[model samples]
Target: MVSDTEILAFFRGELSRQVNRKLQTVPLELETLLQDYAPADELPYVISDYSNKYGVDVSALDMRNYFPWENLPLTTRLFKGRNFRASVIANRKPLTVKMFAESARAGRWLYD
Candidate 1:
């Protein structure tokens, strides 16, 4: 499986020709070898903010039953998988797991 960085670099390379004519754009470099990783679907649970905040101890989520917050405990439903839709996460607002957990606990931001 290709690493996310590799995918990003490929995308940049694909766009280089359509970008500014004079400006040179070197693609970002990735040092880690992705061969060790398994296929996306076959991979382990994805320990994203959702997992960290709720203390859900799973790695590499299954894309099939990929309902992020669907079956969580009622009290946690509001917060489970909440991080994915946060403006901070969606808009790339520089949030950490701890901060995200705090925000979720506060029930301040929610997406419809």
Candidate 2:
């Protein structure tokens, strides 16, 4: 893996050039808080976790940063040179009172 300073500098330079903004990169600390909808330690790692810590101009939507390099397809097509996979990374909206109420209002659409 590349050094943190290199990553910081790259972000700094790119942001400065591309968006006319300065990039702020900070070291991750233990005091950082996580939302109930978010999971920590999940791999394919992530870049968004940094914005909350660094206050950088970039957010999770920046594909240059959040691109899931480790999530590449593990399987290839037969007799072809292609590899792909569909993965969904979403905020876990585990049933809360508000959501449960909305679902009840909508009625559970069960086929049976």
Candidate 3:
């Protein structure tokens, strides 16, 4: 079975590498938002890779729920106004390193 520590280490290393960021001396926690570690466009692939590497089933995982679409066009943003933008941001459910770790331990996706 994969331990949470192992899962945290994997994410910390993988995300740090992908983002070209330095590793934190402290290990990433369950609440650590995955989006903060990588660009929105890259998050899906990162999650997919993690799922595959650890044999976690991710068929139920929806990327849209966790990530907003890569930036809207300027025209759309302007027309949408502050409320629309705020709603979109508010609706995003944070995908965290802990969720992945839990799913890995369970051998399936655990979050909606």
Better of 1 and 2 by lDDT: 1
Q: Which consecutive 10 residues in model 1 have the weakest lDDT in total?
A: 32-41
Q: Where in model 1 is the C-alpha error above 4 Å?
A: 1-92, 108-112
Of candidate 3, the 10-residue stretch with the lowest lDDT total is 17-26
Q: What is the C-alpha lDDT of each candidate?
A: 0.34, 0.29, 0.76
The TM-score that candidate 2 achieves is 0.20
Residue 63 lDDT, candidate 1, scale 0-100? 29
Q: Higher TM-score: candidate 1 or 2?
A: 2
What would the per-residue lDDT of candidate 2 be over residues 2-105, giving only the tens digit for each residue? 34454344333323122213554432222222122223333113333333334333322323122332233544332324332223223222221232122223
lDDT of 3 at 108: 97
Q: List the residue pairs that clash in candidate 3.
A: none
Candidate 1: C-alpha lDDT: 0.34
Number of clashes in every candidate structure? 8, 0, 0
lDDT of 2: 0.29
